[model samples]
Target: MRWMSTVPASDCGRAGTKSSEARLQVDAWVAKRGGERAMAVRARARLVELVAYARTRSPYYRHLYRGLPSKVTELAALPVTDKSQLMAAFDDWVTDPAITLERARAFAEDPALIGRPFGGHYSLSTTSGTTGKRGIFLHDARQWAVTSAMATRMLTGWLTVRDTARIAACGGRTALVVPDDAHVGGAVMAARLRGRSRVAALSVHRPLEELVEALNDLRPAVLAPSASLGVLLAGQAEAGRLRIAPALVCLGAEGLPMAEHARIGRALAGAKVRATYNANECPFLSYSCPAGWLHVNADWAIVEPVDERYRPVPPGEASHTVLLTNLANRIQPILRYDLGDAVTVRPDPCPCGTPGPALRVQGRAADRLTIPGADGTPVTMATRPVAIVLDTVPGLDLFQIVQTGPATLRLRLAPAPGIDPDDLWDTVRARLSGLLVRRHLGHVRLERASERPQISTGGKIRPFIPATTSAKP
Candidate 1:
């Protein structure tokens, strides 16, 4: 494909010249008519432009919209796509012919390619593959710029000039706690920031003591981590084990329970706790307003809440799933893509004064498992690693790991078509056993489930479920 460098001279921080320009433009967009009417008008126009471009450049879209009208005005008339369908037609799905799935997979697999632009042209990221199949997403130069600009705007919204100056005085370093996996979105973004600014991309896979030590040494001005990890570290901070006073604590990737948010807030009394809603599919999907409502960036993206049958859901009601359309990304046309997260759009305007429909997301909920440590004390094993292991495995369809007991794990698998169940079970058991052993839970037992796993009433599959309180490690 075209591996051209699209990053501006200044890409990351609000202080950079290019970042300042982006901030100005984004500010202008928001300032016009309080950003409501202006954003809607612009989004409609951009959606039309993007649809026409996708039809002309993408073979998959061209065929998908074969008989559609030349001047389409309605978005619901278009077809909806999911991860499996898009990945199955990867070559034709992309606007560019040279960007094949094979090349993209290789690029994503290599640890050396982390943080660097793929083929020196597109910024690439992939989903966790927790739900069965992984999705590889690409962004051309223009799209990447938009992502950076939007991020800068979001960060600015959370931190004021005084906050920024205070952070800079305290070393200006950002500690990003994410999985070490090279292909994940958090790692890719962390690596890119590390290359450009004073940032430490700390892996969540590291031991708790080691992570705390590293954070203590870094004394970062900003701390970013998944919601689960943030809650764990908050406990550490409360116990005086992990000590760092960050100006801002940004949490993403997974949903943050209100209790956990309050606990973290209590632990870090002076820090600003900001929770955001985003994914690999569209990093700038939405940002949390001061009142803790997620406001969509309608100027650059569209989120359509829908029912189970793909029909549009009304405001104030929870959707079965949301359709995400990234207006900024041209290389990969993410038009009407089904993002499995359920969300609710506020019928009224946000009290925070943001000029768009506020959203409440019901995202993934994977519980952490506690197992006996070397000293027989409870050791918490975050579900992220388990998810990574399962996500990377091929030929596996729907699966779940339930911690029936302190040291017992029951695995439920729904294998892909033509796959031998016995062989798949053996492979999964071995890998899982090895991972548990490496994490110091060597005594844990793995057993195949005699019964099939059931999806929740909400139609969500949780990969990790902790044992009962009586069975605590």
Candidate 2:
């Protein structure tokens, strides 16, 4: 707080742009090779520093940590947090006074402000309703620099000398197959990297044939897409319709069966497919090794697998959910925030030889929808972008999508109290049909199921169920 007080809040963002990135990158490089002990030292120092600052600067945290000591090094000493509590008190939750919940939401909804900074120096992004509620986040330049540096460290760990040569041979072009919307993280990243690097964003909403043609022409050296979309492209490549030779197939995916990964590798033949586990909440959460374990980046962030009672689950056991604390993000400090994903920490050291903790996550993989196109051919779409469309619908307490056949879907939903279920269903149908028609699937039939949305054995309700699912819709 003292440091922030020295300069005006608006000017503080500008101060941390270039110099902060260079410094953080250097620190990341050191932490990469410094081993677990070194990382623990840094993590301890950052934990104490951030906790102190958050308790003093953030009004919500100030009251929450009222009785705690001035310095908090142990993460458990802090209470757990989630989206609902913080979002409800959003105006007082942030450290900065300039940010308001309504204005920040308005800024996030504006498509023109996608990659542009808010308050001239903050990165703004909105999350989908996958967690039963939406979220809006802001990252100042300092936090953005740390996120960039952490991602760089992961890239260097995944790519080898041969892969580097392959990237260079193809003019270093990179294509990210993601939804072309401001609310999407991949698009924000692609937009941010335009002049700094060679990157292209191919929207999954485009017709299947068009997406394949665009990839054929780009022939990017590095291709990154959602796991399901990558599999779809693998099929196209095997059919000889897509012909790009990528040295690295980086999947922005997690919790997928190893067979799906192998299928892509077998189809591409020479490309190395790397799986990553990331969320809009914490972008640099973890990355995968050849041993198929996700390694957590614990130097600057804390990951704790907890049970239903918020007790720390022992290693080698699966957890009911996980908690995340982002030491890098100060503008909106995420301290022991409930991320709502199941993960298991490995009891032994990983075979990959990295000293960091290894984890196995569950319930992060989503189903893909294959609807029949107007021409009789089937068109498969990743559930992610489709989520972006449905998440925009307002006033629904619960909703679910179930694909019954090639051209038919069953919808299950519960409207919020005092709202008309029919009106909400109409909005859902119209928006879903609009999305399908835009993707050339106007012939797809939608049905409103009499049954309500059901929870899985995992104790959570999935927003979308695939055609092969045994779950009743």
Candidate 3:
């Protein structure tokens, strides 16, 4: 009987071991209590305490909060601070004065050093800055624990009660499909699943054929991918190539459009499709409720919507910009950080009955583009709307395309290095042109910029901005 019990062959390599039985057991423990109000209560208490600490320890915040609200609740009445202020005082914003921008950059740039904390237990990760400037942030051990709990809630919430059981029984294989490089989320996901031998890390930056093949073969029970990538995979699944019927599909990093959501839902054949609101500036902001409504974590973070004057907007009104205060992370206290993404809190209660506030998020605020039709009419394409089509483009990572003219366009593509720019341009041109007539393709120049692109207030990425409009502005 003892001899009959042997090591499972699936628990072998680094990729395979990423989703092991041991990790799955831990995941079960986390999932069981991840969603309770008690968790949020505990997290909020810690967060309020962290805020007080930041006010004392952080040089930047110490001065910023000089006038002060006596209590943490007074934070809502205070003026909102944008990214510019926090970034301008980059050196003094964090609790640890020793962790400089240079040190953060050095650690983030080194692929080998990722997942290895900065000083003992300090984790570092940077945002893609769909706003203007990319932001670097830090997390400590306690923050990591809260982050883990939040992640469990987001990931496991996608699974049905039945699916959760199947996941546990089938050795619980999970797969994280993202870039192969050291993306902070990818690094965290990889590190979390390191002990799980059944988990596989497949790179979305790979060719479509390769990515699809790997997915069909892996048959991962827990499938987590970016919203755009998930839509593209859904196309493949509809085409009958990718065959895995995942129990859960957790979409993150970018907004999941309605069309793409339906496509993925059909492709997965009743598997739960959900959104995770996370930015490098503030990770684990919210999760999709069982009924598909996004519920703010309100536990580790506070999401405050502000108007033009940085005053709190009414519950139903969309915010001009979002201000976030990250609670669990004291190593780098993020208070009133202006996340360029636009969001509106829904006035009504969620059907899912989650106590947290309900929200409707718009995609990146920088990538909004508009183009002129062949009929001498302007066809406005919002980034959030076109994200449905962009979801189909394979191996496409970060990108920004502005229409230089009706027929001419300037494209800024941050594709995976070595990918053919011509192919991406051709694909984009075809999509943009297919909607318009007599539309001559312009000089789709591929260049790199120092900053990440932004979407407009229209809640979309401007894929093609007419050259004529900028001249007037």
Candidate 4:
């Protein structure tokens, strides 16, 4: 609270190297005001500053904002930046021209490079190409500190101070379920966690069974894993196949559906289940507000929802693309960088009364599905809804359900290590089959694959992908 009281109102729109620092200052100022209106004003001012920075520091922004108005009254006045745009100028767009795609790619390809910093100080990570193109991102020291602070805020915001104190009292070990390879985000997280002796790091790409075994052996009170995988573990608890009573469960990387939330909650024997919404492209974005609404960390990163033309859409209106500006990572200079996820802004103030903007993501734009309706008509299915069902099942950690044909579907799964592959297939097939008419499922076949899974081009994974057309519905 004291931190919020220290925010400087003018810092809300200040650009350049001190953006994050200034954003926090603005946060303190908003906190001092003691309510929602103050936060909204701060958010508006912060957006203005972010656009100002983009117009000046980012090449992509210069082209996007060639003749924009002097004042950014609406977020739409700013451009809707996308992945292709930022990547085109990947080399020039970064604050540091020395960090190139070739250099980042080469660094990411080497597994041995895991846990090592890139360019002497910056942490490097690569995106899993579920969206078709892999991305390389960097986080400077300040960004890391900001991210850590925000993460702590997220956790504490979910649990009461007393609960947090009690959880810490247990000396609960944190097991981060993330990619272990040299891909930028996972590697950075792995490095930092490994450096901390108390926390344990586990690879999400590994078999779910093995991950479960490790969890059982370690008995960590903190369970932080990708949302889908967390749901899988919850399912295992439902089936009596696995059990762990962690004090907290933080889900990320996928949407946590209400159904899956119930399952995970039940599986955890009443433990709190919270969601973290972030990606490799931008380190600190939003955390779930106390009211369970995802609130953007407007002080650190600026997120804009834009239409096809890159113009901002009305709040609560659907966005085809998400443009992000990372205030913390000056080394990469991510000004209005496009993140490939479809998101919607919450239309109203949160019950929790946080001043930051609230969001309800429709899941990654890539995760939706297209299939024939029950009447034989083509139907576009959204994966966010279906994935909720998949996550409730136990043992299946990573999955890709590709519809090879209208009636023929092939499911690729990377089960928990040491799990009975046959059992996983049965559970997944049964759950998936039930989602549709029994006849449409001509034959449900499951296979094991080795590729690491990630959210698709739209910044989320497609639980159901139509083979004929590559686009997600």
Q: Which candidate is the best by TM-score?
A: 2
Off by over 4 Å in 4: 1-78, 365-473
Backbone Cα, N, C clashes tallied per candidate: 3, 0, 30, 26
The candidate, 3 or 4, that scores higher on TM-score is 3
Q: Candidate 2 lDDT, tens digit per residue, 1-473?
A: 00111222333234376765666677677776777877777777777778887887899999999999877778898999988788888888889988888788777667777778776667777675446456778777666666777778888888889889989999999888866655657767776776756788887678777988998898898899888788788888889888888888888744667777777887776788888887777777778888888887777678889999899999999999999887667888899998888899999988887657788888687477776668877677777777776655666666788888778889988776688988989998998898888888888899999998888876677888888632211
Which scores higher on lDDT, 1 or 4? 1
lDDT of 4 by residue, 1-473 (tens): 11221344343223224665545544444443455545445456545655666567666566767788866767645544455566667776666657776787677667677768788877877653334344567777666755765666566567877667757775867777765544546446877677686688886544445667888887777888766567667766776767777778877776655656667877887777777678776766776754567777765566778776677878989897777766555566565666766788888877886656788777442343455655675544434334444544544556776766665566777666578877977887776666553325323344444454546544455545666645322
Question: What is the Cα root-mean-square deviation between model 3 and the actual structure?
Answer: 10.8
lDDT of 4 at 369: 43
Instruction: Rank the models by TM-score, top first.
Output: 2, 1, 3, 4
Model 2 per-residue lDDT at 382: 75
Candidate models: Cα lDDT each = 0.75, 0.77, 0.60, 0.62
**Model 1, runs deviating above 4 Å:** 1-33, 394-398, 413-434, 449-460, 468-473
Model 3 spans with C-alpha error above 4 angstroms? 1-48, 69-72, 154-158, 168-170, 365-400, 403-473
Which predicted model would earn the best lDDT? 2
- In model 4, the worst 10-residue window by lDDT is 1-10
- Order of models, best lDDT first: 2, 1, 4, 3
